[model samples]
Target: MASQRGRLTMGLVLILLAMTALAGRALQLQAIEAPAYASSAASKIQRAYTLHPDRGQIVDRNGTVLAASEPAVLIFADPLMISRNGIDERVSMGPLETQKAAAAPKAIAKILAKHLGGRPEDYRQMVTKTESDGSLARYALVRRHVPSYTYDLIKKDLAAGKWYGISATQDAVRSYPSGTVASNVIGFVNSEGQGGAGLEYALNKQLAGTEGKESYEASTYGRIPLGRATLAPAVNGTYYTLTLDATMQLTTQKALASAVASTGAESGEAIVMNVKTGEVLAMASMPTYDSSNLSAATSNEMVNHAIQDSYEPGSVQKVLTMAALTDQGLVTPDSRVDVPASISSGGGTIKDAFSHGSLALTARGVIAYSSNIGTTLLTRKMDKATFIKYLKSFGLGATTGIGLPGEAKGSVPTASMPDFTRDQISFGQGLSVTAIQEAAAVAGIVNGGVYHSPTIIKSARNGQGEAVKVPVSTSRRVISAKASAEVRNMMEAVVTLEPSRAVAGYRTIGKTGTAQRIDPSCHCYRGYTASYVGIGPAENPSILTYVVLNNPVKGHEGSGVALPVAQQILSVALPRYGVEPSTSKPPKAVLEYQP
Candidate 1:
């Protein structure tokens, strides 16, 4: 009886312990660990995929495609299929089976390396990466922007199961078809498919479209079966239409290239603007680059000098001073002023290009001859406040809003500055102005002294193909029509008919600039900036052109170097735009003073 009771007690205790253990395990799984296990299971089955949106085309005014996005592909892989360690299912395997599984990627790598130009060993590492759990990685990058032929070869292999786990998606590669023509204006996209510089950088927001997304049930082997997917479609980028004329832009670039080589200039820039409409017809810079391969481009090659750089503008600014004198009725082209060859103000001497002691000149003569001393004397008639006001009215000391990135607002001295600063700035010194700013300011004189902001983008279209309206221009009348006429007449005298750079049949008006360059490090005079700003068809001017040569080694005078370039661009542009020769005879220039 005692032995029976002992056996029964032992069996009852064993049964209680077993029941308690089972209950605890059930509680842990159903209550404590349920959420975590559920999350892990969902993670193993579901994934969210990114969809890339299509970028837009950048075209010229006449539908010439300057920049566009071409079809491309981005290659990816399913880690489970490519990586031995990525297989989640446990299977009993022998040594030979394991060895064969490990060597599969090596075979695939050899095939990929043949087309991609990388070593098979390097590719082997990319395909065999694993997760923390020693399972195959879910995703891997192969290549981006693969050409059609290369992608086709890989796709064929993938379809035949010659390579497992590889896949590709539709993508785009940005291309500049014109190839180095207007590259500075068009800019380039970077390796990551983002706009890096120039208009590419400026209009990136409009050009880079919205990214799309899709969520679906994918197989453990990394295949999307298609019907279970939910997609949020991508919105494409807006198309850009620039005001640049392709033919004229090419002409201007060739002219700049020839000028930079012939004159041995460090760099050069040229701008052709519509005097009446403020349209930037063509802007060109030397040392330009191929926007396709910016990685090889230098700092100089990347800059859009026409709008980004500012120089002293030299005597090209004298036209503005002459116009100011005529506008206020303080002087006229006929009014005479006694001027010395050199004058002293603010303890600094201002001299002409040539010394003529106690000379007399009309206000127009000051501009026609580009006499610095004469212009300085003319400023004496107006107060400092009025003079500075006139400068602002002409769009100086501010950006011209030419729809480009990295535009510079050229510097101007304060109205209350010393007489030396005043004198120098009055004749295009002691101040900085960009080529576009000078062009727009000259355009003011061309458009009857009404200032209009310069623009490069002619029009634009949204992704939905809706026309995007350009911003309404804010223009203000700076001078009367009569004053602008006299200024144009004076400038016309600067470029005469016989033995002149002006196209024989067309009437021309211009100003020359030979300003000393200020070194950035020492702030001292170094080389020279030779420049010329001209207007044509003097009876009713239509176009305004500006050319600037930096540190010309061969010539120091504007007439010698810069004038020829200005004439070259205008001679081609005028005829291309169908501008006719002046029917009337050239007007007589009364350069001699009559007191």
Candidate 2:
């Protein structure tokens, strides 16, 4: 009886011990491992995705769109998700099913080719590609930047055919609506949807905007209904309003291209500025490619020549020299000066463009006739320090403060410059200046001596479409108003020299430049650079037009080649901008002094 009781006690002890162990295990699981298991479960079902924001739209001042982005899709494939053998999770299939599974890649390729416009064999290769480890590739890019409607068609085909593993994601594509108009300024977007050049490159951070992300619960088929989801909405890029007139830009481009073609020039560049505001109304560059078709562009064609390139501006430099001399009380427009047929300077003979005897000429006559020796003689009277100070104030030996990528800050001579070099520069040689710099300097000289830094951005809007305040351009006084007026009047004589240069009912003032081209490869003079800069309504100049032609094979003279282009640009720009006609004829100057 005692043995039987001990047996029962042992059985009861064993039962109690088993019960205690079960209770301990339940507590451990509920308290310690519960959070970890829950987290793992959530991780298995949760999916996160990047949300790309729409890129900004670049528009003209008049709301004309230049560049924009459109919605698209990236079609891709998961070869690993597709079954190569007729086995479902290690379960073998029948012979018929196996045969069908083996033929799936070819059949899938056929359906893809029907919509994507590629050979079935190519698609099959993409779908059947393997990794270096001899395993099926996990992911493969089928096509990117596919139109939404086209992808919808592809999706419909995929659903009807019950094709698996192929999928698509959202994307965007940058587009240029105006094609080549202001292309060099607007620049082009690279394949990665990033700005490649010009303003697009300079302001990329502001224009690209910020990306966002979203997390949600998903299943094998699709998103789970009533699933836990969190979204961080994307912020679209800023909307830029450039100070460009699209119509005027197109006009300038066409005129410049025509001039370049007719003159057999290597390339051409032009810039039109609003004198009162210093806004670049139109900037054009020739040998330019279509902004929409960048694949056909050459490296040279992509250059923004107006600001990127610099050259010796020939007689155009005379305007600045004459202005400096007049401002310093060194000479007057009517001051008499004896100009010989030729003068020896630095072991080189200097003469006017046209041969002449030892004729007497007024200071204004030197500019009117573009006499090289006469300009040299006049430059000899001015001190180098004062002349260089005036040039620097006029935006030389420095950038014009025009916000552009790859702008050239042209070189200038210092106070200790050689006399020969000074003589050469007095007539627009021995120094370099860009088209933008020269244009802005001349505008400053005529705009009551105020030098307003040039600007291309007129305004901007934030992602939410709220108007953002754009910083106004910096301005400073460069010369006296009296001196500026004198220079303006002196330039009128240049216009009077050519009857055809006068616009009907509009008084014009300008300077022509024809400097030898400096070859970059050899650093030697190769051909000639023809350029012209002009302002309209001489009494109150409003618009400034500048044109440049590089290495013209047919004609190398600024008057014959570049002046016509400048004239064409001004004729259109003046009328388009509502610039008033001249109120009175300019006072005729005494070009020659009588004995």
Candidate 3:
């Protein structure tokens, strides 16, 4: 009887121990591990995706679109979905078994290839792709920026329940309606819809809007209908209104292209600036490729030559030299100087374009005739320190601050420069300058001496059409107003000397330049750069046009190759912008002085 009681006690004790262990396990599960398990379950049911915002439109001052973003879709593949469906396993079994694995993938790839312009094999490879770790890839990009209409057709097939891993999301593709027009300035976009060059790349941050996030409850298949969700709305990019006039830009490009072709020139650049406002109405680079078809473009053709290329301005730079001399009272338009056929400086003989005996000519006559010897003789009167200072004040040795990518700051001769180098720079040989820099410097000389920094962007607005303030271009005085007027008068004499430069019904003034081109291959001068910089209605200069042709085999003179292009642009731009023709002719310049 005692043994039976002890066995009963042992059985009670065992039952109590078992109850305590069960209670402990329940507490641990309910208190310690419950949150982690709950989180794991939630993760399986919730998902988040990025919502891309619309990129901005780049438009001209008059609201003409230059670069725009069009609606499209990004097609993607979920290889993990293919793996989950057992197609991956079948694909590993060599097309023998029912060929079901190869069949599904082939069908999907074929459909994708038909809609998109890719090979079926390529798509199939992506669909069956694996990760770097030897596991099936969860995601793969089939194509980006696919046309929306094309995506629609693919979606129809997907809705038919055939396509398993194929999917698409709304996206954008950049479009250039003007084709190659202003391509060098507007730039192009890459396949990923990112700015690849020019203004597009420089202002990419403002052009590319902010992306947002969207999270929602999703099952193994897809997002649940009316499931719990959270969203952060995206902000679209700002619309940039540039100072470029689309019409003028097209006209300038056509003229420049024709000149380049007719002259058999390597390449060319042109810029039209508003003398008063410093607005760049047109900036054209020739041999430009269509931004829409970037693969066909060469690296040389993609350059923004107006701002990127720095070359010897030849005589076009003489405008600044003459302006500086006039401002310093070192020379006057009517002052007379006896010019020789050739003058020796730093072991180099500087000669005029035409060989002539000693002749007496006024300062205005020296500029109009483009006498190199005469210019050098006059430049020698100024000290090196003063001359270099004047060059800097005219916006040389620095960038024009036009706010474009890859802009070059053309170098200027300094106080330490050799005497011969200084003399060469006086007539635009030793110095290097960009087309835009030259244009702006001339504008400063003719625009009452106030140097306005060049600018392409005029205004900016948000996606909601609200104006965003853009900093105004900086301006400073570079010369006296009287000096500017005198220089304008002197340039007017140049047009008088060459009737070909004169635009009918308007009094024009400009200088022609022919400088030996520097070849990068040898770092030596090989060819000539013919250029012309002109301003119209000389009494009150309104517009300045600068054109330069590189290595023209035929008609290598500036007047022959570059002047016609400048005239063509001015003929349209001046009237188009409503700068009235001159009612009275400019004062007659006394070219020669009789002793």
Q: Considering TM-score, which of the candidate structures 1 and 2 is the better prediction for this target?
A: 2
Top of the candidates by TM-score = 3
Report the alpha-carbon TM-score of model 1 versus the true structure.
0.91
Ranking by lDDT: 3, 2, 1
Better of 1 and 2 by lDDT: 2
Report the error of model 3 at residue 258, Å. Answer: 0.6
lDDT of 1 by residue, 277-297 (tens): 888889998889999887789
Alpha-carbon shift of residue 590 in model 2 (angstroms): 1.6
Clashing residue pairs in candidate 2 (N, C-alpha, C atoms within 3 angstroms): none
Record all residue pairs in model 3 with backbone atoms less than 3 Å apart, i.e. clashing.
none
Model 2: weakest 10-residue lDDT segment is: 81-90
Which regions of candidate 1 are displaced past 4 Å? 1-40, 84-100, 132-134, 158-161, 220-227, 469-472
C-alpha RMSD values across all candidates: 3.2, 3.4, 3.6
lDDT of each: 0.82, 0.86, 0.87
lDDT of 3 by residue, 379-410 (tens): 99999899999989989889888889999999
Candidates 1 and 3 compared by TM-score, better number: 3
Error of 2 at 29 (Å): 3.6
Model 1 residue pairs with clashes: 86-135, 86-136, 315-513
